[model samples]
Target: MIEVDCPSPAKPRVSITYCTQCQWLLRAGWMAQELLSTFRDELGEVALIPGTGGIFVIQCGADTIWDRTRDGGFPDVKTLKQRVRDRLAPERDLGHIDRP
Candidate 1:
């Protein structure tokens, strides 16, 4: 028998950067938990990065999924899930999130 090499797909890493001075750790942690719960299989890891100046940004791999400054304010859980789903698995349906 001959053997062939096969490589596994690289799962995307999610990074949530929140302002430390602004005291957004809970918010960041909540977001991270949401992502991990939703994309347990799709994501490689979810990281919370402490930042300052009231920054709150979510990134998938190297792509910025959500920027609080640019987008204007924080995103709701549904919106956040949709953004992450779109980036990692556009073809995957997010149940009720996809509706309405």
Candidate 2:
């Protein structure tokens, strides 16, 4: 008899890469917290990656959801939540955040 390993399906993961030199750890951590809180049941994990050269990027799986330089600076909490929700759970409602 041969033994085989089978892996279960994994939930979505979010990664926030921030610049260590720029002191963005707190900011990255806060964003991770927000995502976790909002998507408690939907997400697998939230990772904080340290980088330099003023990088602040938020990625969901293999897709880059937000790039500080490309998106023009940090996103407000509301916007960040919306973007994340869109990727993780498009049909889910964000209450006040969904209101214009």
Best candidate per lDDT, number? 2
Least accurate 10 contiguous residues by lDDT in model 1: 4-13
What digit string (tens of lDDT, one per residue) describes model 1 on residues 1-100?
A: 9995442348878899999999999999999999999999998888899999999999988899899999999999999999999888889999988899
Best by TM-score: 2
Total residue pair clashes for candidate 1? 0
Question: Candidate 2's error at 30, in angstroms?
Answer: 0.5
| TM-scores of the models, in the order given | 0.88, 0.89
Instruction: Provide the overall lDDT of each model, using Cα atoms, as 2-decimal numbers.
Output: 0.91, 0.91
Candidate 2 minimal-lDDT segment of 10 residues: 4-13
lDDT of 2 by residue, 24-100 (tens): 99999999999889889998888899999999999999988999999999999999999989888899999998999
